[model samples]
Target: MINDIALGPQNREVKQYLSRSTRDSVLGDLGKVLAPQIKGRGTLQSTFDKHCIKDSSSHRKYWTEESFFNHVRGSYSTNVISGATIALLWKSFYFYAYHPFPLDLHRDAQIDFDAFIRATLLIVSQCDELLGTRELDWYWRQDTAFFRKASFVRMFRSIAAPDHKSRSQQQVDMTSSLSDAMDVLVMIGPQFMHAMPSEPQLESVARKLFVEGPPVAGGQVVRREDLSALIRLLLRLRLKERIWGTRCHFGNLVEAESGEEYLTEVLVDTLTGDNSGQIVTFQQLTGAIDLIPNLLLRFQQLWAVLFQPSDAIDKTKPQVNEMELNSIGGIVSLFVPPIDDDSAGILRFNQRDTRLTLEATTQVSPDSLDTSMSRLSRGISDDSSAYVVIFTDDASTSNTVIGAFFPIPSKTTHMIFQIQPRFRILRWEKTELSRLNLIKPDAKASLSEFAASEGSLSSNNAPYWIGNPLEQGAGLWVDPNKGTATLINTVGGCYTEMPSVGGTSNTGENWDVTIQQARMHIFTVRGSGDRKG
Candidate 1:
């Protein structure tokens, strides 16, 4: 009747074969042979030879006791039982003896708890055979012995070692063991949560495994140092599966895309939500933060190896040097925000302009100045106009202003653009005039002529004022004699040589020629582009 309950569509054929009288008889006989070994009264070798070895009448003459033993020890042996046969036997045993199968069997037959325990013991005793045969389901079920105090430590050690297994086989065993461990935790998690406060034994085991350390076997000593190593091993296995394999478990909560993502989600949820119910401490929280840099460094090292540049020096060498490691360490250190202090220099200039340097020294707070003035007593010597530009610390240009000190004359006024809060004048340079016609015969007509025509300077200075020089769009023109010429279409802002009525050469009623100095460009502008006025 129990066999009537289907395992799945995939197992239908195996289920039918298992239900046959002949196969059932064989399984019963196999159980009889294993019962002695499970009870510790008989050897595993004798049990294996009785159940696993083929009859002499059969054509399989290679299935000898010695050959089966070699296969169990992870040696290459073609005489071992087929994987399908092993799976069928394991499922039959689980259904018949392991009382409460992990999945419901929908059977009315009473379960024999003693028989189930013995069956599990037998399975664990033959773990080597199961692992070598890649019987993952059976291996997983046997890990339930983790609850048995006498066997848990031994199981832990067994899972930790791969011995002579190949890399691929080792990975399979580690993943299977990890999954089983998580399943055991899930099975016990609810009971532990409900009774942990009152149960000292459970609490003691928890503290030993997670907090303190596991008890060492065959000695009175407890190994505290092995805690991290054990955790590292588990993490490495979980990470390998999540990173390279398609599916993996994150505790018993949910399947995750990757271990990294699972970790990130857990950390975010733990920190962001009300965690009064969670078993976390302040020390543990800070300890996790402290581990970030180290984790990042390790990840960087792995990434460097995984995604190494094709053109890297010494392509044959896979090892990273100390300098490279330190570089990665430095990158990891950036996770912590650096301390800010006013005592340290805020800005440093590697290259300096003598003129701006002179101006910086004269002002009490040159750095705080909103606007700077530079008086060009003789105006620009060349035909090109100068430009002052400010740049943020990130090297992006923040502000640009045409240098107004142009059209050689007795004196010219230039006003620097307002310096923004976090920006500084990076450089200034001579830029070609956007409007070369600013000095053309018609454009350069005297302000006196305009004043005479307009009746008074006060009535209308707009007619004599030249607006943005690059209004027509300026660009660079290559000249054979002069390397390049920056041409502009208009004069910089408005300018007039006409002195105020009651003003001296230095001071005026509304305009000062001497004291009210204009800021000149601090750096040179090179290359070519159109300057639109």
Candidate 2:
């Protein structure tokens, strides 16, 4: 019956509908026409020869882009395209069985539809692992569900016949090859939405596909990368669907404490803009979060660390602070109370934000060592010097010779700093000005007297911590690998070999920052609440 499916001439129809230059290029390459002999060698072979997949010589030439369209197109009428689409969905669903995703997601791993479908089928046919077996079975059963829904009938009804006069001609416009494939998915959605096979039905399909082959042994193993890719695809589609509406709601906020500090956040849509949202102060955010899922737990951990108060804030400076929240990978949604009187009440957690505190940290050591500590702040320096200030051993790290201050001071301050690694301190510039002013807390000192004293208001000495090419830390470090400064940072508190911030390496192994002259930019993932800055 696929032969009965009357898709128009392949070449003419395909060129007219190519969505991107990449697709057109692929088709152009296919048009040049290569012999089967060249195509046959692309198949991968196993070392032990146990899984040597001998390329079916006939199928080898079909690797071209045009060939792909022809295969699916030819299979259109016979229910083969629908069947294959279901197969793809089944295979895609296997990702959920082995690798769970956020419930709100709409796309599967392997953002590339062809690659995803091909990989799923190949894995089902070859992989003997548990994950593989479960995947194959999952897809096979999904195929059966399509039959129960009678989706083909529904699709045909909606589609216009070639010569028929119809009012809804726009509805069945499968003019492009891509449209044809999408049509198949549109028809197959109902089957995928159904429950998995019952015992009897499972037995039925198992017997039918027995000739095709058995499933892999351990089921499907979905890796984190796969999950990330899948989530990205779904996010793109959700954006396409315009699912993100204004007035997003972040679910309940969860408060967590690390040592003496507290960090908190409520699950909100990842797309919400911090600058655009309602400005909620630190006082309002203290008891706002609610714990719901394991995802929220992981999210809370990251938020706690990212929001920890930093030592870089100078109580002297005033600036309009903003907060940015991003998912580790994709845009995820959280439920919040409905905003209006709509019958169906649910919250969309797109990018939503409120005013919150920005925290920074600074580390201090004894001045005898001539060592510098990196301070995290909102400001930048071209020389990449650490903002180091020497004090009489009594002042808090917050007191400095030069600092950014505000007209109206706030109770707490957060400053951030980035360290540019070099082997030694190339130079140093220091200045001391007497009669510096002070802005000490709970002080009655007049403006001029406060400026003259050595108290918190004093700004007599100005020192710039310059990069020392020879000065190195005790930990691991490296300069640019392949001309790029090598930098290192941890992931989820776990060490993994990643590209050197300034170097090039395949393995993401951790490198010591002090030992190597690598100019690495380090990022800390953390969260913070309003109190105890």
Candidate 3:
């Protein structure tokens, strides 16, 4: 025998008891204060109210037509929504719109919560135009009543609003979208090695990211408009699937109303991998995509062992601003990555966050790049977060470098030790960005320093944090006053290469580039050790 779930009269008592227990556990001292009267003294009855069972007004299973339409912005009146409008919310509420309607009944059709949700899953992910007719036939055979309901809804809406046909028809045409015809092929671009989505297909779906580019050049080289569009879409998809977290996590990244835009610009700039103001070659696009996994954008992590209402803004406020929603702790997010194995070594007590800005300089910090690490981190409430240091260069040179120091900050020594990430040094020779990290034990110095001496960065009474460079190790030394960086360390240590690069420092295999003009930035990660409450 299967167990019932608060249904039937038999299991009703169990559900009522469960609900009472749940309420008692959460009510704390308040439960005692207002206990008797609310609980009812004589012959109290349990009600299976929809509001009582669900927390959200628009919960997929619990919502009525009226509540759900109001929950979704732009959904407008209940049962007055079109498929195109529902499609717009697919990213945020895919589950809500994909379970009710599963076929192309009619474009101008007015749909209830049931039809929109079913149609969504069918259109976006599971769509296979090759099998369309057969599947429709199968679905019609499976549920003839469902088809009848859909047809009646469409017929009624058409009769009520005669003008809907012209307006809705132009909103989503085959030429403007990846729909109705040959499906499942719009996303698999050439970079992923699937059948490359046609240029027409790309222009149809992702033309927004394009910058009104020049005419087509020739083979392999596409119009500036097309390349930009393709790159942005690829970057957006990878980030949605890889770097950015769930819709629930988006609110935490914001510091202000424009916080999401600030973070989005940072993410988009980082993925572009080019700021020379030139069209990124096909090679650059692929290289940037390949680098996504290794390119980690992190910050000093904030850990909350317990949650409190005051810790977040007053969510109950009648008009909760964008900053308050989708938030954790006090800070609302724009796009925060999930905490997982990829976070860092040391468990970090916190991790690191590094981002790019809109200007040529990918180095601008959200805060300011002051002289002292402690001073830079002074304003950050969460002790485990990273320091911000932005450095922008001109259009002449090409390299962009971002680095952070990870470890629990020592109040005693005031020193920062390298823990999670190995050293990363990037060189922009012309129009490309390349990286070099020295992790192998055999990585020794290649004598590129003529005016400078050899050894390592000083561990003496320096005010800010510095990595203790090995005699054979490499390090990036930033001199804020000069706005220039040396090929190898001019003060002490010389530059070394990654061990995986296959040649030794003394073997004459080289990496560092001498820049005529340069700017530097250093972001140090400080753990909230004594600060962790």
Candidate 4:
């Protein structure tokens, strides 16, 4: 049944090459032909006639954003064009026909689309924009998974219901056109949680899509599938913003890497399991742990757990089930501090020493521990508790702690902490320091006397400041008169400190101070052994 042309290898290669090149040339010509038709002027047939003629392919102009929008509009309005044909045209031009532009052009498209929506809103006198022709078409063509015809109908109803009694014919016409377009777009398209939306416009759209109930259309009640689709879209958009929105300020740690890669590594760390029995070092875990506090700041609720050497120390061996851990102690116990702090008034786990002591004395069956941990795990998965964990070796330093939004091996050598979908860790920039209350009026006190006070020690009795005595710019200072402690910068004369309350003085000669540094971290207990009375 083979054709004579396919009998020879050389003939087959020649035919394949010709087919690819001819396809490319045809698409390029199509782009030039359709570019002018999208401007809402010529019909698709006229544009095809003007440039798609056999000899008219000589002039190959690049497709611009304006032209792309124009084509999208014109193709949708063309009565002669089928949805499948329009989709094919878009795929051809978008992938191979159009001149290559910067990836930022996609962003520019979004901006232009947004502006178009705003203009449409003005015409309709509605605060919310309609999910019209352009939006539905773009969504269907760009990401068909998230496109739902029912959702589009519901959104249209919400935006089309005008508050004004006197509706203009132009507004009526626009709505009618968009409605027809959406009907076709959704018919051709396939169907597909949350940090709050940061952008005002996104927030408004999200509220409309998720919070507001879907409006009835054609005397039919809104379907659950439509509501579900809207929710999915809202969550996806918010998550997209979180991951790609900003750089995470990891103090000096994020040097030489793009924020996007840094985020990717953190996420990888969280999901990775270390089967090797080697201890996970501080340096290895620092980058991933550095993101937890920022994540907490972004998403208020975080579930966390701590694992010690004795609790499944050999991570190489399959670990206990999460449900097992939950049965013994609920996951909430991890965040709820056994002993409350009055001054700082923040819920925190016991000190490293106390935790170590409890682990040594406590005796529990592995089965019991597993059951407890598993229940705790369920709470986290069910959104009843936060979902993050911490791990520490028996001989680890007491000064610093690490936390993550995922479970890690008990005795893993290297851990990869991935940023969870619900949270985003942004780079804490120096400019943002002004927003925090880190400075106060100076009190009359000698720096030497303040350094000698008991307040110089941290709550855990660790040395509050660590630096070289011989270095002038690298030491700790406490202003006794001002009731504040400062860490002298190693590279600069500036010091960073928490401002003291009620230390203000009206003296014209008051010392002016500025904050130079800050750090944020999240911590939690691995086991409830320490909580036993």
Candidate 5:
């Protein structure tokens, strides 16, 4: 993540992270099209994709520019950018998926010079992985979390020597950097109000920030090159206080569960390239992490725990609940308090169609089918809230669940990717926005007539389920009221190719008839705190 050519944190005339020459060179071919700051979305119209990348739209609705600015008032710039989080900064920065964001974020807008520089750096830096600008990735399809944390470091530098732009490195004072650190923290917080620490504690965190780089002037000041690194480390330490709304030390979360340990061990070994084909000792895991020059900028984006303290704190073990750790392919879903014995997870798929995945929850039991699936059906059938469909397979090696999530609910009779409820052709993972949203077919077509079928392709209402009904392009479907379901993928290209999902070829595999898939489960994914389906 370090820039070899423009390694001057003291040279404040250029971009903090990306050297000006590098920023300009990267944007040369693109010209002004990918400019960083733009007027606004309405201006962009249809060419919005050129501006913002929208791989996944988890937010059902959007807050107006006015409303959004209000939410991040202190931290976000409001005047020059003027409700321009996406326009000015986001393109070059990492859009945090710490929460759901607006779906209509991409807009046709204009761009400015600094904005352009940031955008170009963002695209060029990770050009090997993500192609262009994009929204927050909920599923993390491409391992990009903390992907650009380094960029933040570049923007921030020597708060001790705050005046990086006007003065030369030789003239700058680095030991005095602590002056602006508090202001930056306050800007990023409603911080740990309940866990407010004493002034000495904050100073300690700030002073220790300059961990790397050579000490300047008889060790009294830190080097300019290390200033950006300090900003990045500071963010990792503080930003979560804003998002998670609780002060967390590693000890609190780790004591609770296996968590991402299996996932952690797997990725760390990949980072360390130790692939010993044996268990990873704790020393090896930590050592591998330490060897990486920049923990935040690893190409794999594989580093899991970024901000562990040098010393342990909070030795008390908080009361923790059992949670199900489900992982498959590049996806990992944790059901806190654990999913019920009956319900499986949810899986939504496809784009731009009325079709959405039918969902299942970790709440409720499959054995009580009479009330479960029926109520889920009635819920979507009646309530007009957004919903998501979660599809899971028990047979897969890694137990990965596939889904497309859209929390917004619509009225049109959209198509559905079959996943069943707590029980229906396994509860066709879906929400009944309006009376099944099914187009009645002329006369009763055979099960082979899926496209023109009399009702939805799959439903958790029981009887016949397709898709999760477990089949390939079939017209007929049947659920035996048992714990199993069979699907035949004859039309082809039905399943996504995931080796962890037992996918053999680069292309999708077929059900080929003998499919005895496991029973369906259900759970609700909402902040309402109710886990019931």
Candidate 6:
């Protein structure tokens, strides 16, 4: 009873017209062209609007003088601001590297320009290790250099070379230049953390700030070998400011190359409990002791380019502890090893409990002398590394304190956060065998052949189990004649998922037996049939 309405081939004219309409509609909507002419003209135009400037004056003949003047100023302002923003982005990355996770969660203004420079240098050092290139080459690749020199397109081009050079070399050159730029920045970053007195107030402050004693005697200066000295000095300054809850002001210095000056600021505060802006309280400072070295080392490298001394000339004795690690920031003196070695054996500064307790008492407990003294004795009795920490107080002035903890184990590797349970790793011997073929498993080896395995003991020369019954994580059917293992889980007409004679789908599943024993039994039965007497 059904009548068929058969469709015929479409008319060439109608078909062509429909296709042309669809093509045009799509092209118009997406701002593209039909196939074979699919140039991204629309995308290019959008990019031009955001990044390029094409004004009325460039096209028109009747441009006014006022309009021309405004354009020149506008461009200059844009370039300066953009360059600074690029520097800020580098600073953010520096902070992120140390605190891969929120070590100071819900903390604000944790990073400053000094920290930023140190972070960049750390990245360069890591890159150097991975690629065997100069430490500076890791920063300042063409892409990164452009970002640092944003709004100055030509500056980037000047750094990039077309021939006889690799990207690494170009990066090294740029980093060296950038380091010089950062030294000027470090001089001024601490000012933002606190306010300085006016010229009238400086007279009173100057006495307290100036050297009060015959300072630590000078030592032979080994310039290149003493990078740690300079780095430690900066760290001390940073820590001192944090501990005292004070602000530092270093006046404006012009950038060596640009000769342009900009204001810089650095701030540090600690917070406790739920409060956002409050100083971090004493109780909250407990775990921070472990972080001191990591923090100092990380920041030093990040901003290494910025702080490197500009002088090439070597001065033999530039005053040892001239830039004392402890005095610069609100940092308290801790043991730096190899201070002097006159004894039968080296008597280095060790971070013992007593030292930390004594240091803590001097800084924190002005009234609780008895308790502080007890703490010092008790602290020294225990054996652990001691660290000086800066702590903030809500009702009182900032205090520096010391903490003691056993050294972190060597085998421990840090994850970003506590996402895994702590476990002691068992160590084993390793060897550098010549032939990689030694890595291949012998056809005769079984699970028990491995030293640590607990399965049924396999003999030294026992042949490996072959055929379906022994195929792990899969069901197997035995081959009565030519015995050899074949995979059972593959999907095809040849493979089956049906229950075996043991009433289980595979060695992985068992009606009653344990999975491990089940696998072992299967292998044993299949492998030993011919060898059994």
1-533: candidate 3 lDDT, tens digit per residue: 23333234434432332223321131221222212212111211111121122436655333333332343322123233333333323221322132111222232323342333222222221121111122122221233333222322221111121122334333422122222121212212112122233446434433321122321111121123332322222122111101111111111222222222233333334333325232322223323211222221211111000001122322322222111221111110111111112111122212222221111112324332333222223322233443323232442333333332222222211111111012222211122111112111121432122112322333111222123334232333444344443233222233322111111113244333332233333333212222122
**Tens digits of lDDT, candidate 2, 1-533:** 44324433432233233322232233232222211111111221111122212247733221222222333343233222233433333333233222211011223222222222222221211111111112222323234322212221111211111322322332322121222223222222222222322344323333332223322111111222222222222221111101111211112121211210100111121111123243222111211121111122222222222111222122213323311222211111210110111111011111223112121212222222221112111112211222222111112221111111111112111121112111111111112111112112123443345333444312222111112222221112222122111223332221122111122222333233222221112121111111111
Residue lDDT tens for model 1, 1-533: 45434334424433343333232243243344334333223332343333343446853322332332343234112232234323222332333243111222222222233433333433332321222111122222333222221122222232121234245534543333333323322222222211211223322332333222221111111122222222222222111111111111111101122232232333333222224232222212222222221232222222222212222223233223211111111211212111111110101101111110001112122331112111111122233533222212211221221222222221122322112221011111233233232322123444334323523322222211222333222211112122111222222223222111111111122211111112222222211111122
Candidate 4 regions with alpha-carbon error over 4 angstroms: 1-140, 143-161, 165-533
Off by over 4 Å in 1: 1-199, 204-243, 246-326, 329-533
Task: Return the number of clashes found in candidate 4.
Answer: 46
lDDT per residue, candidate 5, 113-196, as tens digits? 333232323222222112111221121212222223222222222112222343433232232233223222222222222233
Query: lDDT of candidate 1 vs native?
Result: 0.24
Which predicted model would earn the best lDDT?
5
Give the lDDT of residue 123 in candidate 5. 28
Against the hidden reference, what TM-scores do the models get?
A: 0.16, 0.19, 0.30, 0.17, 0.30, 0.17
lDDT of 6 by residue, 1-533 (tens): 12112211223332333233321232132111111111222432332233333346654122122222332233334332234332332333432323211121122223332222223222322211111111122221223322222211111121121222235533543333333222212121122112222223322222222233222111111121122222222232211111000111111111112101100001111111223232222113221222121222232232322222222113222233222222212222121110112111001111111111113222222332122212222222222222221111111221212111111122111111000011001111122111111111233432224322322323222222211222332222212122221222332221223321112233242221111101110000001001112
- Model 6: residues >4 Å from true position, as ranges? 1-373, 379-533
* Root-mean-square deviation per candidate: 29.5, 24.9, 19.6, 25.8, 21.4, 32.1
- For model 5 the local lDDT of residue 153 reads 26
